[model samples]
Target chain A: MTTLSAGKRLKSAVCSTEIMVIAAPDGDVEITCGGSPMGDGATNGGAVDPGHAEGTAIGKRYVNADGSLEVLCVKAGEGSLAADGDALAVKDAKKLPKTD
Target chain B: MLLEMAADAFGDRVAFVDPVADSSITYAELLAAARTAAQAVHDSGAERLAMLDVSNLAIPVGLFAAGWADVPYVPLNYRLTEAEIDALLERITPAYLVTDLTHMTAFGDRQGVALTSRGDFLGMARGGGGDEDYRSMDPEAVGVLLFTSGTTGAPKAAVLRHKHLVSYIFNSVEFGAADEHDAALVCVPPYHVAGIGAVLSSVYSGRRVVQLANFSPEAWIEIARTEKITTAFVVPTMLARIVHALEGQESAHMPHLQSLSYGGGKMPLAVIERAMQLFSDTDFTNAYGLTETSSTITVLGPDEHRAAAGSEDEAVRRRLQSAGVPLPGIEIEVRNDEGKALPTGERGEIYVRGDQVSGEYEGRGSTVGADGWFPTRDAGYLDEEGYLFLEGRADDVIVRGGENMSPGEIEDVLLEHGAVEDAAVVGVPSVEWGEAVVSAVVLKATATQTELQDWVKQHLRSSRVPERIEFWQELPYNETGKLLRRVVKERLDSA
Candidate 1:
């Protein structure tokens, strides 16, 4: 688990000896947990700017085929489970069926 | 001159190390290779040559060869389309094109061959007449023809001379404090003046340069760590990549990293602060200049950063936001519409005159006035202390009821908001206000245009607030990642 924070914390991740998260895009999508809204180079755009949070499992939902939204995040141990907009939150992600 | 100097002093010392393949060329070997290449090209009956490759060992070799052969070298932008290349070829009408024969199909019978195809480059030089001895001649003799980024309109070639290149290297050391031991990692495209400047500075100083054929986040970290890179000349976009790459790591691998130089666009204060935090020991030098000027004319050193943070004086704080003080040989003056120099602390066009500045573009009317000062088209002011602060481009300034409003100031304020990801402000024609302030922003949170407008109104004056606000997924920017104000305005006009 990486400890990520915003602004100064974001910079601290860059130069300091502190462990920081290096997020790579899985295409035009991203997944995050225990990461600050000040996530380095994360795209958060829409009417409501969903602020990122630490320990709050969050993942991006890209517009998909059949005009549906597919969220790319792990639920329980299911590894990269997909859900609609309603199941996008961390709590919903946890409540979904576990694979193991 | 620098190559000759290096050959004389360093001799067998490693002059260039190709980071891509881990190959190197010693100074003595490089001199021989360049001589051989020059002979081969001269033997081929070509009077001039165009190099189409990216940054690598061959660039310097080709440059020296061209110089020794007394032929002009034209560098083609890799980003430009085939049509653009064809157009450039038509304009310059070169006698030969020298690039790696590996990519022979890319040129398609235009010109050139491998340096080894004839014979071992250095060994082949034995019997041929020695390279034509050439002294640096008139400053107007074209050394390179660089094309401007066509963000506003069609691209035009800016004729660069040997004197212009010499001026850049001398002033860069004066401003950037570069040295022979300094290792600079260049991430910008080699086609651009900044990229070329990085290569030239390294060669001129005889320093080790780690050339990135292409920029990758992982590669940047690895290079900085393994090479003990002391300097990184980057665009803001590249810096963003570095920041992103360091996200989950305990610490950046660039412990030996000293300076991160930025230009090509206005860096948001948030970005600067974050970069400073990431590399606590590393200095951030905010540089501002244009390709026409070679590279940098002003640099805001790291020391001023702490001063700006400590002082409450608006002037001191504002210095942090300005373009920065003029480099040693360059003099900048703020002039009014009439071209009369403005008093200190007044806003006007930024005019620069110096030995480092370039002459007028070839076959083009003088951009520099009769007085030898180039009207930079950048709207800025000279503070009482002689620090130069840039507002925006003169064309970007929105004149409403005679008040000069800088969109950059508004954009900076918007970026300060936590919800804002990227912001751009441009002027749109208005029926009532003569010109309306329109803002296009990419937000991190869900917010209405009203919310963003209200946010701006709360922080800025009523007149400065945008008349209309629009949200975009991303802002339109040039290849250098500079926000395109003209495009934004055009989008608004079409909308």
Candidate 2:
């Protein structure tokens, strides 16, 4: 189980995927990619599961239900993301306003 | 962390370009330069990295270097007098100053200060190699130290922490959101918060930034057309000047120019309306914030702009004059002098609280309350629907015969006159009324002082009319479009 914290970057142990924690949950949660537990950027490789091959895209935010967890993908990968045995949905964001 | 993410995601993409110099840098190159410069700053043992020049490549390099070196990046105003700059330089001693060739001799010998010209700084930056451990650094470390413009008093260095800046980005902007073809034109001076915000926001959004060393309406229009700029940010006066440059034209004629955002000062309704007609195909955003709030805390988006312009309801149409609602993570409240939250439509001090609000100064302690709200010192009220209408700085409020009056209120009335182009209302000394209303206006068509006074009298309280009126060709403004009220008072007081 990874202790979720805001701004912490995590890497998939199974594929070429990277994400940073934008909003953390109240407690430690086991997050997985391609049915393999993810690790920090430096980690040992693990085999991918065929059932969880929906893939991920860069620059998209993924969030689970209840609105407590949010992660932003920094790199694309051919592995889907899951937290606590549930799938994370890609958030449909509003067109951002230019704030500069 | 922001640059690291961008470099890792799209390292080969062009990031910053200088049109005049005909040069550009990629995201990876900027990352490398920042790391290399950070190492130099670490080796010199400087407590801070300060930049004192017009906007250039040194800005991005100096900014990230300071962030990576764990020192606050202080951007100095190139427009300041030598004595004024020295007074500020004295405060940030044990600092590394990155300046152009002209300023090398004046500040090179200062105690506990290391200096480099822009030329040498770029050279060292280009020879890039260093390790960055920003992920391990403290989130609360100071990231930027911006001195308040201090039109009211001596400049105070506002402290912005890493968390505050990062929070602002995460709250308002999504990473890598700009399309590949998007190019942004940045022309504001380095000292202004909008300058810094424009860089950081554009970088994180994966937009190519085109820099203009100086601003002229002709230069701005030429670059925007040539570069196919999709997005840009400007202060009110800059927008006004651009509108004037295209005075006889119906459209800006650059189809690729998609978005334009303006802030830093009150935008005259006439100017914005004219700008809308000129850039009919473009989206207009009005962002409102202060140096202490990282940049924009509120935005009136393009859709809202169109709605306000098209609405049949007088109340809905009045939103053109509003500053819009607060950002996602920000909370705003209008409060009276007793620190009590006022109801809607009651003009008072605006207090803001959020992770991005850095209310502290270098020497002076924080003005943030125990509950985390930072008093903006700006007088404004929220409409029933939560649109904020600014009434100018609270300090600028006029006291006429023991009654409080807002100058913005009276100025708005005068501006509604058909012939008046610009106006400034000031409270001058008057023994009878304690403070008398005085005005100086710029007119496009000829209008007499009596005619203007009657125009104001018809719209506002009789006591609100200016006791004396002075007509001038133009009013004094700083580089960022902020009215030099003190200068106006001095000029009119003497006249």
> In model 1, what lDDT does residue B292 have?
78
Distance (Å) between predicted and true CA of B287, model 1?
2.0
lDDT of 1 at B181: 65
**Model 1 agreement with the true structure over B1-495: per-residue lDDT tens digits:** 546546655556666677876777766677777776777777777656566666777777767777666667667776677777766666655455644435434554544322232123334543344454534333445566677776667677776666677666654542112355667777777667787677666665566777877788788888888888888877777777788778765556577787777887877666666677788788777788887787788878778765775578977876667667777678899999899999997888899987657746657855877788999888888777788777788878887766778887788788878889888888887887788888888888887887778888899888888878888888887667687888888897788
- Per-candidate iRMS values, in order, are 25.8, 1.9
The pairs that clash in candidate 2 are none
Off by over 4 Å in 1: A1-100, B43-47, B100-106, B110-140, B174-181, B248-250, B309-314, B401-403
**In model 2, which regions exceed 4 Å deviation?**
A1-4, A10-18, A27-56, A75-80, B130-137
Clashes of 2: 0
Best by TM-score: 2
Candidate 2 lDDT tens digits, A1-100: 8688877777888888888788888878988888888886654656668888999988789999987999988777888999988999999865678867
Model 1 fnat value: 0.00
lDDT top scorer: 2
* Model 2 lDDT per residue over B1-495, tens place: 788878988899999998766778999999999999999999999999999988788889899889888899999988888889889999998999999848545798888879898889989988867565544545779999999998988999999988888888888888888889999999998889999898888888899999988999999999999999999999999999999899899798989989999999999998898898888889999999998999899989999999998899989988998999899999999999899999999999999999889999988888899999999999999999999999898888899998889888999888888899899999988889998999999998999999998888888889999989999989999989998888988887777
lDDT of 2 at B403: 88
